[model samples]
Target: MTTEFLSLLCLGLCLSYEDDKENERLSKPSLHAWPSLVAEVKSNVTLKCRAHSQNVTFTLRKVNDSAYQREQSSAGDEAEFPFTDLKPEDAGRYFCAYKTTVSHEWSESSQHVQLVVTDKHNELEAPSMKTVPHVCNPRTAGR
Candidate 1:
């Protein structure tokens, strides 16, 4: 009876360790944006996907879109996607996921991030300005 109990206890400990390793492997990658989350129109924006594991393929997708952007990294665990000449239509939510090359299994999806695009000139203008401000007067009171 003593031997049987020790065997069961050892088996339980091994199973627990396996569970912990699996949970770590299934962990999701993180997504980050360069400069800022809010970008101006016609500006460049870069999105980064970083995973804890190495030699995995990273995928970035826009929410509600069927298209998928894929990148593979052998040297590091991060991939970057750049958006040039951003427009209002580019504003949307994005997500990142990673898959191991050997297992071909994907990790859990990362948290969603929202990208906002605003007009550069309009952003510099005063908030109360209903119409375009005059060059001579900075405030909207004159217009």
Candidate 2:
């Protein structure tokens, strides 16, 4: 009877250990973020992108088929793109993409950002006449 009881206790311990291991595996959650686009005319616009794992390679592509620019996220698994000194010719669709080294999978791109850069001088205002202010005449109130 003593030997039988000891075997049962050992089995219970093994089962508990297995349960703990399973729980540990289940606790790790999946991470991922879709890219987001921002319409900005030069001078730094943050293009947001996220990854589910650590050490992700973030990149930006000019939709007009320009060269791809890589951005590493030291701040986290997210990254941003800043376009400086925006010119009208720089206007185009842009996309953000990220891939995780751990998973080796790339997240779906964020919505396309349509950057429409208009010339500063082209954005002008029409001249307007200034209106003169009139003082309230209390004597004319009753009349």
Candidate 3:
């Protein structure tokens, strides 16, 4: 009888441990900017936040800022925040996070990604690659 009681106690402890693990915070989402980390003025980029679950709300925040830059409810597994007409003000360290629509707790912030913006001078096409001249220009081609 003592052996049976000890076995039952072990089972209860195992179950409790599992419950604790289940109650842990949500996993951190992966954040990445498309094309490249460095961007030129008047260019475009997308910051994508990928989470483990769908139907969650994603939030983008620039480091050192008090408020979130953008938030969206994503029905899919990832949320994209597009930055168009890039400017020097938009260049900074950014991170993202997400939480279930029904939950108040937010997942941990994603790894930060820096967006370096170059000067706003008129772009010139490189002498070599003239195909997509507008996209890859002399000023940015070296970057």
TM-scores of all candidate predictions against the true structure: 0.66, 0.49, 0.67
Q: Give the per-residue lDDT digits (tens) of candidate 3, residues 77-135.
A: 89999999998889899999988854577899999999888763534533444565346
Deviation (Å) of 118 in candidate 1: 0.7
The RMSD (Cα, Å) of candidate 2 is 10.9
Task: Please identify model 1 stretches exceeding 4 Å from their true place.
Answer: 1-25, 122-143
Give the per-residue lDDT of model 2 (tens digit) for 1-143: 99999999999999988666444321122222222232334444455555554566776667767665555654466665655666666677766766654334455665676766654444455325667889789988868
The number of residue pairs in model 1 that clash at the backbone is 0
Error of 3 at 44 (Å): 0.5
Using alpha carbons, what is the TM-score of model 3?
Answer: 0.67
Q: What order do candidates take by lDDT, descending?
A: 3, 1, 2
- C-alpha local distance difference test of each model: 0.83, 0.57, 0.86
- Which structure among the candidates has the greatest TM-score? 3
Where model 3 places Cα greater than 4 Å from the true spot, the runs are 1-22, 120-143
**How well does model 1 score by local distance difference test?**
0.83
lDDT of 1 by residue, 75-100 (tens): 57888889899999889999998876
Candidate 2 collision pairs:
31-52, 35-110
Which has the higher TM-score value, candidate number 2 or candidate number 3?
A: 3
